[model samples]
Target: MPKTGVLIETENGGVKAINYGLLTAAMGNKENEVIAFITQNDAAEAKDDLAAYGVSKVVQLKVGSGDINSSPDLCARALAAAVEEFELDHIAGLATAPGRDIFGRLGAILDVPLVSDIQSIDYGAETAVKSHFSGKTMATVKLEGSPVVFTVRPNAVDPVENPVDAETAEFNADVADGPKVTVKEVKASQQDKMELTEAPVIITGGRPIGAPDNYKMLDECAEVLGAAVGASRASVDAGFAPHSMQVGQTGKTVSPNLYIACGVSGAVQHFAGMKTSKVIVAINNDKDAPIFEKCDYGIIGDMFEVVPVLTEVLKASEEK
Candidate 1:
């Protein structure tokens, strides 16, 4: 059996929810031995959670030279050392900003090809499926080298529980810091909202939202659903929402399980970003809006009127 190493991402000292799905993908019909690798959090605390998704061994990687947190090169070098130390056949991680940075550097360090933001993988075949041409096509790519490296889109795979007893180990890598770049400081997001790409559910507003303060409506509904709030490119361009919250071809690509679009006109650019959502619900006053044709469910009404009722209904259901 091939040994697959999954780079586990953590938040607040716990494994991120999306890592479980990556673990599921690494499992691959129970034919591959899944090893969980973590850098930021305590391996012992994450072992049980990782093992619930069939990870048998959890490795905590530490660098003996410089701070891996401050240097992406150092982090990649340390991970490369671990890949060699463990003889990992494949290395996988989430395709977040940090993941992309480290994996890009790691690919250069290892002189190997890196495929990123893939929707699915066949570990046994060393192949992955990823979107191309602005989400219009999907290509199955075959990796042709030792220790294939790839990053999967968050929430692309459904997590399945396959419990196992896990053991933890520590790997201390002695890697020299590169002189290229060192991060000075990192700023956390001011809003304590779920990350747009990692969120399982997202509620988005469009140009018709009118004002920035009006986003409170979406925020309230998002809070009730435990979802992230997003804005269409039109809303962002109109100054009703920030660019960071924008979801479209020029913005963040999301693959949420449930995507709620309010007052969005279903432009191709916006559709390209969220086309992978499992279920899409659209609310608009125009019954013949293009969104109605693309959405799984359609509500023909003004978002101002439909959203409050939806929020109240969700609240009442939660109360029960």
Candidate 2:
């Protein structure tokens, strides 16, 4: 069995729910031995969650007496050392901002190829599938290396629970932290916006949303559904939403369980960003909108009228 190592990501001091999906991808055909690599987290607290997802081993990678949080390069080098020490056949992580940075540096340090933003993988064949040209094409890439690296798109694959008692161990990499860069202070986003890539449900507004304040309608609906709010590029361009809220080939990519596109015309550019959503619900006033052709469910109605009713219904359902 191939020994696969998964770089675990955590939020609020616990394993992020999205990491379980990467665990599923690393498992592939269920023959690979899954080993989880974690840093700055209590292994005992994380073991149960990782074990539920079939992780056989939990290796806590630490650098020195002080925390390695300020040094990303040092962290990557440490992870590379762990990969070699464990003799892992393959390694995978979520393609989040931090993961991308660390995995890219780790690949460079290891002098190996790093495949990123992959939708699916077949470790048996050493191939992974990635969407190209704004999701218009699917590309299968073959990786060639002793221990290949892969960064899976968040929420791209569903998590499966296999339940194993994962053993824990600690590794202290004896590598020096070069003074090249020291993270002075880490400031998180002040806004409470849910991460677009990891949100289970997203409610998006399009150009017809009229103005920025109009997003309040969607916000109300999203609050009821526990969803993040997104916007098409057109809405961003028109100043109806900020660029951070934009979703398109030029913006953020999302793979939520449910994507609700309100007043979105569904141009290919916008569709490319959210095509992987498990279920898409499009609401547009124009019956001939192209989104109708691609969405799993389509409603032809004015968003102004439909959204309030929907929010009320959801609120009523919650109350009941």
Candidate 3:
């Protein structure tokens, strides 16, 4: 069986739920050995969670001098070392911010092809599907070289649980700090917050949301659903929400399990970012809205009326 490695990313000292999907992709019918590579976390602590998703080994890549979070170069070098040491046939991870940084560097160091933001993959065949031209086209790419790198889009694959007994190991790579870059201190703009990309459910507001304060309704609904709140480009441009919350062709792409678009007109740009969501529910007053055609479910009504009732129903379910 071929051995595959997954570079796991953690949040708030716990394993991110998104990594399980990558693990499922790596395992692929239990014909391959799944090894999880972790940095800035304990292998023993993460072993149980990783094993739940079919990981056979949990490796902790450690550095002696500097923190891996601060030094991307060092982190990449360490992953390269692990890739070689474990004889990893393929490497995969979430196409998150840190994964993009480190995996790009690792691919450069190893002189291999690195494919990012893939929608799906056939790990056994070393092929994947990626979006192109603002998601209007999907390109099937074949990875030709050995030990190829693939970064999957978050929530693109549903996670499957296949329990295993994962063994833990420690590998301290000998990597030196680069002269050009060295992180001094880490400052977080948003920590411990539900991010739009990784959240399983997302509720997005559009231009008709009216004002920034109006997002509270969505927030209440999101709180009930354990979801994150997002905004369309129209709402952001109109100053109803910040750019950080924008989701569209010009903003961040997301693939949550469930996406709720409240008062959105269903512009192609906005749909491009979240078309891969498993289920989309659109609430708008216009019966002829374009969103009705794209969404799995549509409600032709005022969001101000529909959203509050939705929130109340969800809240009531929890109380029961």
Candidate 4:
């Protein structure tokens, strides 16, 4: 069996939920040996969780001289070393900001082809499927090399449990940190906010949201649903929301399990970003709005009136 190494991402010393989907992708057909590689110090804590998703081995990768989290170049070099040591035939990770940076550097270091933001993968064939042309097209890419390196889009694959008795190991790579660049400090705009790309559910507001404070309605609803709050390009452009919260062709692309769009016109640009959502719900006063055609469910009512009721309903259900 080919040895497939999954670069596991962790938060608060525990494995991130999204990594399970990456594990599912790496498990492909049960024909490959899936190994989970964690750069954090809590691999032991993550072992059982990873094992539940079919990981047979959990490796704690550490650098000799510097912290891997501090230097992307060092992290990539350490991962490369681990690949050589473990005889990894394939390496996969979540296509998050850190994953992209580290995998890009790893590809350069190993001189191997890297396929990024892939939605699906065929491990045996060494092929991956990814979106193109602003999500208008999908392309299947084949990697012709001994070790296939790629990053999967968050939540692209549904996690399937195939429990195994996993073993834990540590790898201390004798690599040097790059002298040029080092991450000084990582700051979050909202520390408690969920990242939009990785969120399974999202509630978005459009231009009709009037002012920034009105986003509180979406926030309350999102809080109840354990979802992320997003804004349309029109809202962002109108200064009602920030660019970081925008979701469109020019903004962040998301593929959530559920998407709620309030007062959003079904523009192609916005649709391109969230067209892959499993279920889309649109709430607008105009029954003839373009969004009604694209959404899976439509609520023809004023968002101001409808959202409060929805929040209360959700709250009541939670209390029940």
Candidate 5:
């Protein structure tokens, strides 16, 4: 009856569906007796999707949280209590911004390892998969103790639709002594509203594409694939594309299902952002490009000619 606990985000208009994917990865091949801890902000939005992520139990944590600088550590400690109460084997949270603070506090107090930025979780093996060496490699981490704490990257795992009759319950996740270090003010980024990392399909252009004008072909192909546009650092720095769509070590790391890299040379930094994509298709004139090493399929040709053909084929399929 190996099971785990989930820490769901309910505040700041956060989505709780990511927790389901985290839970699915952590509680693999175990009894369906896991608990999910969510806050008020996301409660309304995250309800139906909890089961879609394979959570068997829902524990909505109520603290005087919402529109206030509530202590994330307090919520984390409360979830720690839930792990003890429900007797779960692991406690998992997201690797997003808020999760960084929550997991940091909980890991220290609980005296357990906090696995962060995990890309996958092997429930049977009790191993957590994380990107390491700045996304150059993947590392599988195992806890040395019980009730392990972990924070996972968003869009890391494919959310499983394993239906379970979940028993929803409310719990007190309030800590007696609040956060040692409190967040006084909030500073939000005023940039492009949409995050390309979370987009289902991402199409990125790299240095090999050569000129700024050539990227339009890549963009056209992206439109054909119904994918968001992305660019490697070289493409962005060379003013071929905007910084917002940059995908690499100094840019947004994406975990899309379908990643089409046109003219990318596959630097370690570039792969850091898109290596997690389920299907990688690389198109380059040079057959020796490093991107070919990790691509599911490769095409040796100029993207200028190849992308147009692909766009036409996709458009024809859509028309049908």
Candidate 6:
């Protein structure tokens, strides 16, 4: 088995590590060691969870005043240094946008093949199944050399609370002498409601919901279920929902415990954000919708009608 060094990308969503399924997956793998390199920005709040996930050592580096996500070179350099110092055999991270950025730079700097966006990672003598090529094909990879970098898909693996004795090591990491990009302004996305990624329960609306006003029922369902409302890219692009509510690669990655889909068609782009949910329930008009395949349970009917019924039943269940 290989020793795994996991980097926790920080600042915006310290919640990212808790949401991604790999934290549990890594801890469950007996032979793989989990290490976290946290940016100074999130060093305090995010450290405990990393430790709980079996992070052998947590390294902290001050990122100055720049955005960790935008500093691809600096991010990669820090992680690469840790890998070299620890002689780590494998490195893994979330497949989020910032993760992708750092993965490219780290792969280039480490001069190793990056097996990213994996659905499952099993360490044998030296082999694993990584679902890429639109999740249609699996690549059986053998990490021929040391420091194999992997970016795993969020929600693909289940995050388990595996507590371990953690050691926080404060280190002055090697940062890039010069930065390629400058962060002139950092504007956090503004929303009155909860962040979709942070929500424990999510109710996502898809294209067939008709219009934005129709969200009343979806909202009602979410309210009854005590969930945050979300939307598909198709619905967001249609102006039915705000971009913050979008669930996909181009949007926020969500790993809610319970995810309910209404009127969604189940596009791969949509499922990529929510497939890792603990329990998925899809309600669409068509039985053949792609979302049904990914759901643990599915309902075939119009969401407009189905959601209200569900809302009432859920509300009643809560009372009982």
Best by TM-score: 1
After superposition, which runs of candidate 4 have C-alpha atoms over 4 Å from their true positions? Answer: 177-179
Error of 3 at 84 (Å): 1.2
Residue lDDT tens for model 5, 1-320: 76777777653576544565667765666554566777665443555667656667777676444322366666666767777777878888777667778888788878888888788776656787788887877788886567777887877876766766666777655556646566677766453333576567887788766777776786677767767888889988888877887998999777878888888898888888888888999989998988898789999998878889999999999999
Candidate 5 residue-wise lDDT at 74: 65
225-284: candidate 6 lDDT, tens digit per residue: 768899899899999888878987677767678898888887777776666678999888
Q: Which ten residues in a row have the lowest lDDT in candidate 2?
A: 173-182
* Model 5: residues with Cα > 4 Å off, grouped in runs: 9-19, 40-46, 65-74, 84-87, 123-125, 176-194, 208-226, 239-244, 301-309
CA lDDT of each prediction against the hidden true structure: 0.91, 0.90, 0.88, 0.90, 0.74, 0.73
| TM of each candidate vs. truth | 0.97, 0.96, 0.95, 0.97, 0.77, 0.78
TM-score ranking, best first: 1, 4, 2, 3, 6, 5
Clashing pairs in 3: none
* Better-scoring candidate (lDDT), 2 or 3: 2
Off by over 4 Å in 6: 9-20, 41-47, 63-70, 192-202, 223-237, 242-259, 265-280, 285-296
Could you tell which candidate, 4 or 5, scores higher by lDDT?
4
RMSD of each: 1.1, 1.5, 1.6, 1.3, 3.9, 4.0
Which residue pairs clash within candidate 1?
A: none
True-structure RMSD for candidate 6: 4.0
lDDT of 3 by residue, 1-320 (tens): 98988999997799999998888888877888999988877889999999999998999888767676677788888888888899998888888878888888888988989998898887666678999888778999997667878888988888999998989998888776552467787776553448788899999999999999999999889999999999999999999988889898999899998999999999999988999889999999999999999999988999999999999999898999
Assess candidate 3 and give its TM-score to the true structure. Answer: 0.95
Q: How close is candidate 5 to the true structure, as a TM-score?
A: 0.77
In Å, residue 243's CA in model 2 sits off its true spot by: 1.8
Clash list (residue pairs), candidate 6? 24-160, 155-276, 266-291
Pairs with backbone N, CA or C atoms under 3 Å apart (clashes), candidate 2:
none
Give the lDDT of residue 178 in candidate 6: 59
- In model 3, which regions exceed 4 Å deviation? 190-192
Task: Write candidate 4's Cα lDDT for 99-164 as tens digits.
Answer: 999999988889989998999988667688999988899999996666889899998899999999
